[model samples]
Target: MTNTMWVRGVEWLAAAAADPRACKREWDHGEGVALLEAGRFWDVLSVPERLGLLTLDLLWRPGLPVPGPTLVDTAAGRVGFLLPPDPSGGWVGSGLRCASRGSWVAVPPPYRPARYLEWLVPPDGSGTLHGPGALEDALQQANGTLAVLAPLCGR
Candidate 1:
């Protein structure tokens, strides 16, 4: 079944991309994660969608290395992506991969505005962050949270 929340998130991203101010304020990694954790952002996207957003965020950031590996913390785990390396030293945009999964997934070209919104947040709201090695712990915590919030989420 298609996830309605993911669809809504894509719509939100498209609208934000059309407005420069909205894009600037809404697309930051930290801020996006904050909103997701706070239930203010869509959080039902698939893992691939989440990775796609992370890759796009890196591309949008100024002065960040492109076509390289980057990692971020999420409620799921420490996800990573490798933006495809530029060819001829020119801007060659492509897809990325999540380190946790190690699978290359294609993203729409940067010119396109169908980017996914960030939905990965720290497992807990206590400001303590975990990494790839903490996957098991994260899963346990997530299960606990799900048990409590599933009803609230109408799941």
Candidate 2:
């Protein structure tokens, strides 16, 4: 994309927070990440890096649409998927975490590089997000696959 397009995409992503200006201000100060409240714009599905890597591959595989923006929190050893908020809140698993209403997540500018947290898949600025059902299906498939293969080296 042209530089202008990516810049707009970054703005689009930061707007997910209640205070997009504050997020932008944080970035202006050279911070690599900003805290954003979940549920309003999207929910966060956080899982172990191992599961995240496998799940992402499945989501991007041949017939499936690519998953939405995903974050890898290296310091936290977790990967977070940005998903459309689900009012039902049915997600539950051994090592999975779903952050919806009343929760917050640290996110990076989708267009920038960061240390602890980086985007595995950045938002396209169209407001598309990972489908909850699709993500769950991918996670389940990944869980089964991990039993035999060693975890891939994560980003």
The per-residue C-alpha lDDT of model 1 at residue 133 equals 27
lDDT per residue, candidate 2, 49-128, as tens digits?
98998999899987777678898988988989989988777788989899998988887787776678888888778788
After best superposition, candidate 1 residue 138: deviation in angstroms?
Answer: 1.5
Per-residue error at 59 for model 1, in Å? 23
Deviation in angstroms for 140 in model 2? Answer: 0.9
> Between which residue pairs do clashes occur in model 1?
none
Count clashing pairs, candidate 1: 0
The TM-score that candidate 2 achieves is 0.89
RMSD each, Å? 16.6, 3.2
Task: Tell me the whole-model lDDT of each prediction, alpha carbons only.
Answer: 0.31, 0.84
lDDT of 2: 0.84
Summing lDDT over every window of 10 consecutive residues in candidate 1, give the lowest-scoring window.
36-45
Off by over 4 Å in 1: 1-102, 107-114, 117-130
Candidates in order, TM-scores: namely: 0.24, 0.89
